[model samples]
Target: MRLPLLLAAVGTAAIASIAPLSANPEVELAAEDMLAPYYAKLERELDLPVAPAGAGLAEDTVLTRIGVGSCNHQSRSQHMWAKIAAADPQLFLFIGDNNYGDNGWEGDAALGSLRAAYAKQAETPELATFRKAVPMMAAWDDHDYGFNDAGASFTPRRWSETLFETFWGSTEEVRSRPGIYDSRIVGEEGRRTQIILLDTRFFRSDLEAMPYSETRPPLGPYVPSTDPDKTMLGEQQWKWLEAELAKPANFRIVASSIQVLTDAHDYEAWENLPLERAKLYRLLAGREESGLVLLSGDRHAGGIYTDTPDETGGEQLWELTSSSLNLAFNNTASNTAREPDPKRLTDFISEENFGLVDIDWAGRTFTMTLRGNQGEERVSRTVSW
Candidate 1:
């Protein structure tokens, strides 16, 4: 069987030195033992430190418009920022993969090349201009978290957390925590909007991939885990999430870096952690009137889906999946698997796109739009909750 690149990243002698811990991940290593050579490599390579971005969004102000997008390749054209800026979004969520710097290695100085990718993104003038006009919040997925499809066992994660917090301007409360899971309740009472950012990587258990020798799964590369002992959010984050949900808010936006509702595919998602997905459903079970919505990125394609009252056992939950701000997977070369989601209400948008959420407080309704940089609205759905 061909080993995945993540496993190959540790093929060098530097990583071999930590094989007692790396080879047997469950033993776990201290942050000090795994951090030095790893972070030192990135520091030596960065053109300059990645400065913090977009702070001081007022909680008393009303937020009527919101935007979200992910899966950005730092090297690609960032023209989408102009379109996002034009929309006058009160808040923009940078959900993940904001910096693509994975060079398939993590244990030693291999991260220098990855640091350069982040430096390139920070220097993008379009993003700089957008940050000036828009107050942004961010959460990282696999790539920007330092490697593609990585989790807790990834040696450099502690250092990766520091880099993420520095670039995105994470809150002091977030910095004090281990994982980036946090909640922000902005806007005044009645018009309050709660943003729940999940850190699916920092404390997550490693994923179990489907063998390459076996037929590739129809959608992506991974197998579902039935082991309930395995966790996606870890104990502390789960406790944090339950408490965050308890705080009352007019509308709640749960931002996950990976898809949550679609189950047909074997790709990295809440589906892989079945019990955890159920727990989320149970948490939102009675929030039918909360104007709850789910936002996710990571899939190269974009689409809209729903978890009806019957499906989730509470309210009508809609999930808007927008991705690949520049990296479109429409071409067959990207992948051959067809995403088969029976619950999807809109056609899969396989082109470059972003998601827009417009709220009409008077009507108690919200609209989710999937559009391209040219203002092409490929799919849209408005829900009255």
Candidate 2:
């Protein structure tokens, strides 16, 4: 079901030195009350008992169906999780904005806010059920990273990263690392699928905000930075990504929390770092035979984008953007202010939606589908490699 707009407002207050409760007691109690019926329904529907924490499908398991989406508010009703679970995707990718804990406070208050958001998500019956059914992988965006449109300068990033790892069950090795960027290969030899999760927030340079103008609406106040020194993935992560790309895999999915191929928009996207965008295009173009596809979330709308021969030197690149698992951007007229993309495979969907990618390994084909709350496919496209 669609939820009310729950975007976290940016706060400027500093955190107090005293430790606070991990979660607001009143909110926690209310959430439990609200989730009682849903949990009861879930218990009735699924005969199997809840699996132990971190119990999920194996890492090298072959995936036939994959679910993707972002921009979830922790307090909202996540009925969409049940719908996504029904789709039976072998893997679920939470690309970013997994929660809306946008508290600007540092120290204990910030930590407590982050903990509270994750606590709500963990306690949600639909999500808890979904986690038992499918394995999940996630990355962070601005809101969940403790601020709105945050970057390297966001001081509380280290704390947010630690909280993210704790909630998501990331390994100690990963937690000890610099950023959350990681890569994994699933399936065996001929049918392997490589999933690269990028950390866009950890080391990203500040975006160039455009001057106030009535013309900008959906695109926001960000302009493409011409500074050659600006970087998105940072030096170490860039090197790691290049190495990961060089590895063998039948198909590869590069997951980013922001749109990479849509440069016409003024919104926060890879376009804001033009040179980095070009580097990514070139990287994929160089590895054209690897069967590359981009999956991104952040825009609060769902759509598919493509880069043709001219853009990628004869290698066509496709990107599917699914966003707003609970909160959707329903105002379509306002989105018209952004420049139109000719490569868009379908019109932008402003309803609460999730993305599905179905791969037919033997047939070398895949279908990308966007589904609404009622479990109806709003848009779909099938392509063969």
Give the number of the best model, judged by lDDT. Answer: 1
lDDT of each: 0.77, 0.76
- Residue-level lDDT of model 1, residues 44-96, one tens digit each, is 76544464365468879687889999988888898998988887789899899
Residue-level lDDT tens digits of model 2 in 276-312: 9888877777763667778999988878888764547
Quality of model 2 by C-alpha lDDT: 0.76
Best by TM-score: 1
Per-residue lDDT of 385 in model 2 = 80
Summed backbone clashes in each candidate are 0, 0
**Deviation (Å) of 65 in candidate 2:** 0.7
lDDT of 1 at 170: 74
Write down the TM-score for model 2: 0.83
lDDT score, candidate 1:
0.77
